[model samples]
Target: MSLYFFARSLVYVIFKPLYRIKITGLEHFPKEGAVLLCSNHIDNFDPPVVGITSPRKVHFMAKAEAFKLPILGKLLPDLGAFPVRRGMSDREALRVGLKILKEGNVLGLFPEGTRSRNGELGQGLSGAGFFALRSDALIVPCAIIGPYKAFRSLKVVYGKPVNIDELRARKASADETTELIMKEIQNLLEKNR
Candidate 1:
């Protein structure tokens, strides 16, 4: 197996027992074609948790700052994480994300852009919508609950894909699409709460 798959397997083996991870809605995931997995950012562990729980391989956009570390910088890319500069428009990152989708791969993102320090869902950014629109990828809203604690049970819920075509036909802007995505995530979180 590739390093990425190996690492993901290791994460699943370790965290599944430690956190008692429970995943739902795997049936909602597309069997093939491009997909955009959007979820709330609770902490650094959010990415790995989502990645491991997902039915498909997920390529995540991590903050460029995280790539500055010597060892981690070299390893993250192998683990399906690409650098994205926060607080500014990073066209290169956007292009990379779009490319991943166009190549028929799953691209994972946190619509909130950054981790929620208080563990509450925050306002989502427009980047997720932008990528969805640009790549014509299905947006799968995901909710991850109780991942902060290593010994506590953690849950991940994957909602049905958002109707992007209908939303676009309604003249929904990127920000509006992002809001819709966040709403779906919130609903999923509430259902599992």
Candidate 2:
């Protein structure tokens, strides 16, 4: 936990001036309770940017490959991130994420599952929706706008909680819920950009 905060603060101090990072809609972030903070992934820095800006400690699902790195591998879990294998069904990763939400902690997800190659919003994968349905966590859609260049302004915008209570009450599928979550994220990107 201390390492997480220390890394977070370090990112803020280093990236704030270099990127001129600006975040809005932070008020939409809930102060407590189980929350799924879903966002559009754009670059390698997106996770840290969201983590630093969020009021809560975000446990992110990092790529399994990253865990093989000499230093980052050892540090990711300490920073509350677990590994998820891409291009395959990684049930263990899903269980870990759901447990985080069930414990009333924030779990960060990139609905796109990977960074967008075009800097445009891509379709959301079902991870965020799956967690939301299983844990009833609030889905707060966030948009990250950046090419991530030095001295260039970068922005993170948070949208209001997506209203999925009706869908959940009706026992909707995860894919359908994901569509709604992605729609909200796209709206944020369009509005802010």
Candidate 3:
């Protein structure tokens, strides 16, 4: 099996029992084709939780520092994650993300750019919007609810795809797309909580 699936299988076994994760709106995910799975960043567990819960493999733009790790660094790429230099423009990372979507693959993004210190949603960054406008891929909003504390009842709610095609037709700016996505995500959070 591919490392992504293998890791997902392992994480599912552990995370499910430890967290009591309750997933909803997975039916919103398309079985195939390129799509963006955008979610809120909470703790270090965010990426793995999003990837493992996704029905399809998720390609993530992980921090460059993570790739420096002795073992995890090597395993990350195999797990469908590429490193991105945070706090600056990383063109290579952008290229990789666009490539994944252009090839009809899933690319997961945390639109807030980084984890929220207070566990509330942060402002959306331009990355997710850039991808939505540049590529002809669906953008699905996801919310990871509840504390990351062990044995807590955590939830993963996948929202419907934001209509990028409609936005594109109107010549939407990347910022505008970002705003729309963030709003959808905020709505999801409010509804679930």
Estimated TM-score for each candidate: 0.96, 0.97, 0.97
Worst 10 residues of 2 by lDDT: 120-129
Among residues 3 or more apart in sequence or in different chains, the pairs in candidate 3 whose N, CA or C atoms overlap within 3 Å are none
- The global C-alpha lDDT for each of the candidates, from Candidate 1 onward, is 0.90, 0.91, 0.92
Query: Which residue pairs show collisions in model 1?
Result: none
Q: Candidate 2, residues 1-193: lDDT per residue as tens digits? A: 4999999999999998999989999899999999999999999999999998899999999999899999989999999999999988899999999899989899999989888999988887877778889987898999999979999999999888898999999999999999999999999999988
Which window of ten consecutive residues has the lowest lDDT sum in model 1?
A: 145-154
Q: Over all chains combined, what TM-score does candidate 1 have?
A: 0.96
lDDT of 1 at 43: 76
- Give the alpha carbon lDDT tens digit for every residue of 57-133 in model 1: 99999889889999999999999999999899999999999999999999999999888988889999999878877
Model 1 score (lDDT): 0.90
Tens digits of lDDT, candidate 3, 70-118: 9999999999999999999999999999999999999999999888999
Query: Native-vs-model 2 lDDT?
Result: 0.91
Q: How many backbone collisions does model 2 have?
A: 0
Better of 1 and 2 by lDDT: 2
